[model samples]
Target: MTTYSEEMEKLGQVTIFDLLPPSPSNAFSIGDSVRVVITVESDSESYHYLEAYHPIVLKKRGEIIEIQGNQQYLVNFAGELHVMKEHEISF
Candidate 1:
């Protein structure tokens, strides 16, 4: 079986958070309560592979755990963790 590190290597650097500074306009800070505002849908028949926040997390309440620069945020919903864009969530 492929190790997690190897799989990550194959995918290259998925993010460059360390290379960039925190967004000056970040609306929310760590420990802030928020909710996901977007729902994702996929259409396999159209040959389009669209992916975003899961449907289960839509409108669900979560807390900001980390700031990922460029308006991205790491939120904890219950015990589950998900990365969300600034526009995808609201206070």
Candidate 2:
């Protein structure tokens, strides 16, 4: 069976990991614009192609943020960053 780390690695590889950090507050939601282009760690070489099937869109403007260690900083807007779960982002 795939371990949680394995799943998380796959999630990272996809470049669309979850915001299950301290809490959902660290995560962005619908209507919020994307904060950054996070990278998922997958064995696939063509990550972009994989991403194409699952496009990450900014749901809100202030939903997504960058939390490192203990610092929480909101990501600057670059167009519309509507981020959601893999199922939601993916086609």
Candidate 3:
């Protein structure tokens, strides 16, 4: 099986590896505009690809968490709140 560490290593290495946790703050915030970027570790058919998929952060958490921790944010998508990752958004 692909280990969780292995998966995180691939997912975290793409810039976020250096920015997570106490060293630096997350790149986004509530009411901030963000676009979904194509990533190697992401599914190509994700909702982020749609032109109208742009979203605004509704809530944010885990700024002081570790790099590999479950830091996440809530975004306004299709009138619903969805949890999103730091890498899943682009400023």
Query: Comparing 1 and 3 by lDDT, which wins?
Result: 1
The most accurate candidate by lDDT is 1
Better of 1 and 2 by lDDT: 1
lDDT of 2 at 88: 28
| Local distance difference test, each candidate | 0.72, 0.40, 0.52
| Model 1 lDDT-worst window of ten | 42-51
Comparing 1 and 3 on TM-score, the stronger one: 1
lDDT (tens digit, per residue) of candidate 3 on 1-91: 8987778787854555567556456666567655445443565555444424533322222221223334466655545555667776666
Q: What's the lDDT for candidate 3?
A: 0.52
List the candidate 3 regions with Cα displacement exceeding 4 Å.
Answer: 1-23, 39-42, 45-71
* Candidate 2 structure quality by residue, lDDT tens digits, 1-91: 9988789787764423354444444333333443333345542433454356434332223344443333244333444333234222221
What tens-digit string does per-residue lDDT give for candidate 1 at 1-91? 9988668867884547546766578889999999765543422422122124344465368999999966899999877788888877899
For model 3 the local lDDT of residue 69 reads: 31
